[model samples]
Target: MRGTEPPVTPDGRYIVVRGRLWRKANPALDAEARQTLVADLMKARRAVRDAVRIRDDMSLRQARRSVNDAKVALGERGPVWWTDGAPDLNRRLARNTIYAEWYAALPEQP
Candidate 1:
């Protein structure tokens, strides 16, 4: 995966790059809440790895759900953290939009 950190929109609600949009992390989350979510995410990730190693389908499915839930809580997936109705663009990569020039200026990912 590319490591480039996309530029945030003027309002700071979204990161736009290559004409795609990504919701920023929830700024309203308290430090404790963020920490707890991170812990849950890490635990789920470990569970996934262990399940794969053991070739356990049930465990893997449960672990994947947990991972998704954790990500949603962390504002990394699911609904947009912002309430403004800006469409959710969690995973998009295309061209021709307001931010195209900015995206073009970004250094290419290796």
Candidate 2:
């Protein structure tokens, strides 16, 4: 897949670019990394929602990139999941640690 531009969903209602799950829950996406992630998600979301006339254009790499972006965004560096400062249902996870942990164990960079 060269440039699906957006790895759309099956029904076209949402995009699964990354585990960030872009659709209705899309937030302010305040950071540079978050912004980039949001951009990728939007592309995938549009692909599903507006991909008509064409099919099978998105590549797995793009989809994975989007997902990674989201994952990073979801991590602590992106935003706090809640204002209460608690790791509850609506709390955002810690970023620096999460990101570090993710790569620290990696055998090599992709």
Where is model 2 more than 4 Å wrong at Cα?
1-30, 52-110
Report every candidate's CA lDDT.
0.78, 0.42
Error of 2 at 30 (Å): 7.6
In candidate 1 the C-alpha lDDT for residue 25 amounts to: 67
Write the residue-wise lDDT of candidate 1 on 1-86 in tens digits: 26656677666766765557776668899999999998999999999999999999999999999999998998978777788887
lDDT tens digits, residue span 9-107, model 2: 232322333222233233444577566666766776555544433544455445545555665464523444445563322222212322335424534
Q: List the residue pairs that clash in candidate 1.
A: none
